[model samples]
Target: MEVRWDIFLIILGSALVTFLPRVLPLMVLSRMELPDWGIRWLNYVPISVMAALVGQELLLHDGQLAPLFTNLELMAAIPTFLVAIMTRSLLGTVVAGMISIMILRYFL
Candidate 1:
């Protein structure tokens, strides 16, 4: 099949638009020296956001507060948390969570 230049250009432009914001920060910050507090906060931000997102996704529904006992996601998270605390490995946590979810879903 022949390549369409117009379609390629549109895709390329959209790709550039999406990538520029993300690439620009790293490109600009690569040579800049960030303060200690800035670096510390940056390091923690990912973990904090991940925790919030995971908690929200598992426990909340429709932007409202929900109970954990009746929620499958939250129910699955329980085993995941226990394994994570005991094992301290991402792989183990993920596997435990997925398996728990599958078992729960299958039995329910």
Candidate 2:
């Protein structure tokens, strides 16, 4: 068996590059205390990111805005959003979204 040192070094460097950005922040922030307003502001980050992703998927086609009346994914998202809001259950919301898309694709 032959070991390639160049390949090994490249893999190690890639792993370090990928890992540092994620872990360095935690290492630096774990010892510090955030203010009340900062904590409250941070709570919105996940929701904002999720909304951006979902909005892009549901509203865009071929990099252009999709028509509201004819976009099936947008139609499916209606019930999925309602399920997420009403039940607040991740599993239920996922199931609702899957079923909605399946039905739409099968029938239309």
Candidate 3:
């Protein structure tokens, strides 16, 4: 197989554009002490982002807001949410969600 130099350059440039924004902030902030309020607020970012992602998955269908029962993704989320609450294990919750969704997709 022949290597494509043009594609390689595009991938390299794309990666740099993505990587620099993330790395530059960490490098600049490494030695700085953040305010207490800022540290407290940053803690919520992960949960907020996860909630937004889960919301997008459960609530949207074909780029539209789907009705509650009619959404297969939302249906799958029910047991996933339960597993997350009960087990409190990330791996278990993910595996349960995947299995539930695959079964739901096959039947519904």
lDDT of each: 0.92, 0.96, 0.93
Task: Quote model 2's TM-score.
Answer: 0.90
Clashes of each: 0, 0, 0
Model 2 Cα lDDT, one tens digit per residue, 4-91: 9999999999999999999998998788898999889989999899899989999999999999988999999999999999999999
Give per-residue CA lDDT, model 3, range 8-101, as digits (tens).
9999999999999999999988879999998999899999998998799789887999998778888888999999999999999999999999
The lDDT leader among the candidates is 2
Model 3 error, position 91 (Å): 2.2
> Over the full model, what C-alpha lDDT does candidate 3 score relative to the true structure?
0.93
Q: How large an RMSD does model 2 have? A: 1.3
C-alpha lDDT of residue 47 in model 2: 89
lDDT of 1: 0.92
The sequence of per-residue lDDT tens digits that candidate 1 reaches over residues 1-108 is 999999999999999999999999999899899999999989998899999889889877998878766788888888899999999999999999999999999987
- Superposing all C-alpha atoms, what RMSD in Å does each candidate have to the true structure? 2.1, 1.3, 2.6
Residue ranges of candidate 2 with Cα displaced over 4 Å = none
User: Which of the two, 1 or 2, has more lDDT?
Assistant: 2
| Worst lDDT 10-window in candidate 3 | 68-77
Candidate 3, superposed: residue stretches over 4 Å from native: 1-12
- Candidate achieving the largest TM-score: 2
